[model samples]
Target: MLDANLKAQLQTYLQKVTQPFEIVASLDNSAKSTELKSLLEEIASLSDKITLKLDGKDERKPSFALNRIGENMGVVFAGIPMGHEFTSLVLALLQVGGHPSKLAQEMIEQIQGLDGRYEFETYFSLSCQNCPDVVQALNLMAVLNPNIRHVAIDGALFQEEVEQRQVMSVPMVFLNGEMFGQGRMGVEEIVARLDTGSADRAAEKMNEQAPFEVLVVGGGPAGSAAAIYSARKGIRTGVAAERFGGQVMDTLSIENFISVKETEGPKLARAMEEHVREYGVDIMNLQRASKLIPAAEQGGLHTVEFESGGKLQAKTVILATGARWREMNVPGEQEYRTKGVAYCPHCDGPLFKGKRVAVIGGGNSGVEAAIDLAGIVAEVTLIEFDTRLRADEVLQKKLNSLANVKVIKNALTTEVKGDGSKVTALVYKDRATEELHTIELEGIFVQIGLLPNSEWLKDTVALSNRGEIEIDARGATSVPGVFAAGDVTTVPYKQIIISMGDGAKASLSAFDHIIRNS
Candidate 1:
C-alpha cells in the first residue's frame, strides 16, 4: 500500500518543477501482482506534475524508459524501492528535482533555438574514468543545444560499432555523423563544427596537393624508423598511413625492445613520431595508400596514389606495412580486449605478475609467450586448438616444466564472460569430447598468427605466398627503387629491435639505389 504522506511529498516536489518529465513503470505482472499496480496508481494520482505510465505486459520497456529518463530529467520508482532499487529511485528524484533550476532553464532555452540535427557518438574504454566528465559535458551540450543529440557508447561493450567507426583512441567525438575531432577538445572546438561555411572552406584547403622524394608506407616501428632515417639522410621523406603505430599501438607494454627496458605502446609510438618529426619527415595522418605505380622509365621514381585524393612522387620507396593480429572470433572476446584480455604477452605480462592468466594458441609464439608469462603470472592455462604444440622441443619442455602452466590441447575458446568492465572468466569446449568448462582468470593472452598488411602492394611489388613483400637481404624489392623491411617483408623474425635494424638497413639501401640512378 502507498504511504499517503510520502505520496503527498512527491506530488509537492513535482508541482514545484516546471520542466517536462515522464515516469515509466515497467512491471512484471507475474511478480508485481495487481496490488502493487493499485498502489502505484494511487501515488501517480497524487500529482498532475508527474505522469506515471505503466506497462504490465513487458519489463524490458522500463529499461528503455530509464534510458529516456537519462536524456530528460525524470524519476522512475520501481516496486517498493528496496535496497538495490532505492538508490536508483533517490538519484532519479534528484534529477527530477533540478529540472526547474535557472541554469537548466537557460540551457533549455538555448536548446530550443537550434535548427539542425547534430548527432555525436563517442567511443571510450572502461579503463578511462575520465570519459564520464566528457560524456556529461556532451550531455549538457545536448541540453543547451536541442540540435545536438549525444550518445556515449562503451568502447568495450560495442566492438563492431567501434571497429566500424575506426576508433583507435579514446575521447573521440563524431559530429553530425562525421568524425569531428579526437582526444580532449574544449567546448568551443566542439561548437565550431556547426559552422558549415568554415567546414567547406577547410575542406577546400585540404583538397590542395603536394609531392615528396621518398614515400614510406605504414607507420609502425619499421615505417617510422625508415622515415626518420631517410629524413635524417637529407632526403625529402613522407609517410602515408591510415592510422599511426599499426599493431604495435595495441600493445600495453614493450619490454624486449632494446634500450627501452619498459615502455607502453602508445608512449613508444608518440616518441617515435616525435623523433621522426625532428628529422623533418612529413607525416600524413589518416591517409590510406590505394595504389602504387612504377615510373614508365627505367628510373627509380614511383608514383603513389592515396584514397584521400592525394598523390606523391618519390625516387625511392620503403614498404613497412606491418601485420595484423589474427582474432579468436569468440563471443565477448572482442568486448573484453584490453579489459582482462590482451594479445601481446610481452606487453602486458608484467602487469599480471602473481595473477592467474590464460594464453591461447599452440604455435612457437604462443608457447614462448606462455613460458615467459609463467615466470610472472601465478597460473597459466595454455589453450591450444591442435592436439600437439608446434613449438620447438626446448620451449615445450620449459613450458611443461613450469609448476603454474597447464596445457589444454584440442580445445577452443567458446565465450569470454565478464562484467561490463573486465573479463572475469572464459568458457572453453573440448574438440574431441564436446565438453565445456569455465576458468576464472585475471587475464587472457592471445598469441595467434599474424596477417601481413600487404594487400595494397600486390600489383606493385612481389609478395610471397605468406603475403609478405619479397625483399632481398639488403631490403631491396623486385622493383628497382622499391624496398621493404621488418615483419612486413620476407624477414623471418618480427621483433622491435629487429624492425629498427631493418629500417636502418633499408634506408641505406634505398639511398644507394637513388644515388646510383642519379
Candidate 2:
C-alpha cells in the first residue's frame, strides 16, 4: 500500500480525470493479490469518476485493466506497477479517464488514424529506468486508439513467461506474439515502425523545408544546448536525433552533474529537452543521421542525410552524437547478446536473480554493477584486464566487502561460451601465467567504457585515433562551418556538465563563423 505522502499525491493526480473509468482486477487469493487489491481500492477512493471491480476474467493473476466506459481501450498492467512504472500506472488512469495527453497534435492524430488492431505486450523490470518510456508510450497509444491494446508485464513477477520467451533483457516488446524489439523505444519510433510509409513521408517533408542556420545532429545535452543557443540568436535551428537524451538515457544515477546534488539520467534528459523546446528550435526525434555531407563552399549550406531517406541542409552543423557502451567483442558475444550478454546491470540484473553472473570490467561501472548484483544474484565474478581495480577507493572497498563477489585481476575475457539457447559459461585467460579458466554463469554484464558515436563522421571530419572528432578550443572542426561537441569530440572528461559547456561554445563558434562569412 502507498504511504500518506504518496496517497495525497495520487489524490491530486486523480482529480485531473474528466470522465468515468473502470479498474477491473483479475486476481486470485494470494498475498500479492491482496496487496494489489488494497492499492486499487485506495486509488478508487481518491476520485468520484473512478470505479473498481474485483471480479475479472483476465487469465493473468494479479493483473488489472483500465478501460474507458463502454469503450474497448485495452491497457493492462500484469503486476503491481510500482517503482519506475508507478508513473505509467498514473498516466494510464488519467488518459483512460479522458484527460488529454501532452503529445504533439500531429502525433496524436497519427495514432488516432491508425487502422489495424495491435496487441502489444512489453516485458519490463520495475527497477529498469528505460522500461517506463516504452510502457507509457504504448499505454498512450492504447488510450488514443481503441484498436490498439498494450499489456505491460513485470518480468520479475512473471518468471515463467520470461523463461518461456527467452527474454534476457528488460523492455523487450512483442507484437501479436512475435518479438518486435528489445530496447528503449519512444512513441515516435513505434509509430515509424508500425507505419511503413512514414519514412518516405518524412523524407519528402524534410526535402521541402528551408535550410537551417544551425542544424544540430544529436539530441543529448550537447546538441540541446547548441540548439537553444542558436535558436535564441533569432536564427533557424533544428535538431535531428535517433532518440533524444542519447546515452544519458541509459545511465541510471548521475551525481557528478554539478550544482544538482543528485538526479536520474532520464529526469535530467527531460529537463534539458524541455529547456531546448522553450526556444524556437525544431526537434525531429527518432531520426538517425547516416551520413554527414559538408558544404562544398565556405558559408554555404551543409547537407546531413538520414537513414529514413531524408536530407536536411543547414548553414552550420554541430555534431554531438555522443557515445554508447563498448561491447566485449569476444567470440559468441554477439550471438548471445540478448540471450545472456547485457550492457545495463540496472535494467537486466533482476532477470538473473539467484543465478551466477559475471561482470566484464574493473572500473567504476563494473565494480558498481557487481556490488549491486550481489544482493539479487547468487554470485558475481568481476574480471579485469588490469592488475588492480580502476574504480574509486571507496567503491573498490565496498566491492571487496561483498560476500558474493569475487574479483579476478590480470585476466582477459577470451570468449563467451553459450548453448544455442542461453549462456552456459564464460572463458577467460590469466595474463600472468597464460592459463585459461571458465566460469559457469547464467548471465554476463559488460561494463566496459563507451565508444564514440563518430563512425559516420570518420571520413568527413578530422578524428583522433580513437575515432573521436578532433576539435579546436573554439569547438570548430577542420571542415569550415562544421563543429563538434560532447562525447563524440576530443573533449577530455566526458561528463554532462562539460558537454553542455562544449555545446554552447560550439554554437557560439558556429555563429561567429556564420557572421564572419556573411
Clashing pairs in 1: 111-146
Q: Against the true structure, candidate 1 has what lDDT?
A: 0.67
The lDDT for every candidate, in the order shown, is 0.67, 0.92
Off by over 4 Å in 1: 1-210, 297-300, 328-359, 363-382, 389-406, 411-446
Write the residue-wise lDDT of candidate 2 on 151-176 in tens digits: 99999999998999999998999999
**Range of the 10 consecutive residues with the lowest summed lDDT in candidate 2:** 292-301
Off by over 4 Å in 2: 297-299
Per-residue lDDT tens digits for candidate 1, residues 152-254, read 5545444456555655455567766887765544332344345434334432433453545678888888888888888888978888776677666666557
Candidate 2: deviation at residue 225, Å? 0.6
